[model samples]
Target chain A: MLTLQFLPYSEIEPLSSNSRIRKILNLVRENKIVLMEGRLKPNEETDLIQRTMENLSKDFKGIELCTVYPNVKDKFLKGLLVNILIGDRTGLTVVGPANIVKEIKRDPNKILLLTENVRRKRKK
Target chain B: MIIRLRDFISNVFYKLFQQRKSLKLGIYGPPNAGKTTLANRICRDWIGEEMGSVSKIPHETRNVQQKEKIKIKHKRKELTFNLIDTPGIATKIDYEDFLKFRLPQKEAKKRAKEATKGVIEAIKWLDGMDAVLVVVDATLNPYSQVNLTIIGNLAARNIPVLVVANKIDIRKANIKKVESAFPQYEVVGISAEKGHNVEEFYESLFRLVK
Candidate 1:
């Protein structure tokens, strides 16, 4: 079964950087897709990827991470200012296990998250 | 007279400043993207030495390697910099993947551990780069998240980047796909192992750091 876990920005706002990464990675390692409410700091994103690499195994492949932030192109300076002032809490970050989420494609308007299908037989 | 004198002195200081600072060019990319091969090509051409070894097995370069004080002279233009070849960055590193390459289980596990450290080191070294050459394998899909993340992080840091579409010697190589994937940056296609188009590659580096 596939599970999507929604993590609100407020839930993780007070956590340390390492703790935030750990929280997200732990959920991902459990095969739960994390729908995070804010973008991670650039360094945090790299660190998350680094941590993910360390914990990879046959059962837990890795993760597919993507973020969609709108209006950055329209209001570049304003967005930059907001980002600097209140952290990068303007976008949604999707992190899913690679085995479950086949792909995550983000365009200007929407995100296409493709997942793998699993089938099983039921006993009568 | 004082205005002219001030301008002249400022120009001398600027020239002196430019001469004193050495460039650090970092080669970065995903696993098996020919980063080390390109580094070896550049080093062999200029310093007459290879920086490190290359292998079909991924994560062969599990550490940050550097070759210092290499100078290249092409035509009348000269460029010199410290070259750093970083291990390939990846979101996943399973020891079982190495088993496919016939590596023993214990050795595979050891490589995986070192590879994770390498990824961390590579990301850490990003802060120190003056310019970076992001090499991509032309034969594979260029739209991977790993590529986007690496490029995005570099862009956020405001680092000057040049995309090198490597493995052009292979029949399946598609430079245009790589170019379109990163339309904002200049994409130069070359086969590092075959030494094809390296002259042009050298010319691009001079322009990149200028």
Candidate 2:
């Protein structure tokens, strides 16, 4: 009898920024609720949102985004005040399937996650 | 006659402003036990909107969702409360499990981190709760470690608890198993999603807060 060998090294793959996005999406897809730390820069956050919206299609249920900032209410000027105070300390959370995060409902940040099929209980 | 008149006025004053003290009623349970659904049902009937979203996924409520000042009126008896929907509790959370949903490596890890933090937040919120509704899925076994831990915490804090046996609409649902598991606390059986027997749930709430 000949011996056979099987090895799986999938978990060892190095993580990247894109892979990070993929991982977060993977969590949402599996119906697992996740809370991500750290915020993308304001420009980066907007870019990500724009890119996601531009890429949306019929196959996705959309993604949810919730951003948190220091609870500061001070604004001295209409447009110039925000530039001084919101100096990159803000953080954001993106939740949804990898394919459809753009389709998330409401403010993505205020959303709570639920697996797609877990919602089968009848409602009144 | 003067003594009786004084007692009557004092009682009326107590009945008006004092009866509506804002009690914070936190809704706690394991995943997908219809906590949010029940909250939404109560709000829609009174507040005209749902509290938060509900879905089939576990931890759909990762944060503590709040809908304040819901006044329940039943047969002229009334109660005012702030309803809080807390994130589902679990013994373990792994990033790899999230990968099963086809998420990539980074996002799954991020979610796992957030979820771990969320669990801590839920536990911390316990101190602020005046009473809690321990929502449980009637279709599953009720003797799990998660349920016991939740009940244990509530007991330790002396917080008033009412066990909600949710999902009675399903054929497999068994409310008695839940009741037997936590015989110390009163259990109310109702389908949060289908809106069946919700009036009974409200009646139980008035009793819990009273």
Q: Pick the candidate with the highest DockQ.
A: 1
lDDT of each: 0.88, 0.66
Here the TM-score of candidate 1's chain B is 0.91
Candidate 1 positional error at A72, Å = 4.8
Per-residue lDDT of candidate 2, residues A52-101 (tens digit)? 33333334333454443343335435334544454322333434443322
lDDT of 1 by residue, A19-47 (tens): 99999999988889999998887778888
lDDT score for residue A90 of model 2? 37
Candidate 2 TM-score versus the reference: 0.57
- Report how far residue A106 has shifted in candidate 1, in Å: 6.2
TM-score of each: 0.82, 0.57
> Each candidate's chain A: what TM-score?
0.85, 0.40
> Model 2, which residues run further than 4 Å from truth?
A1-124, B1-20
Residue B125 in model 2: lDDT: 88
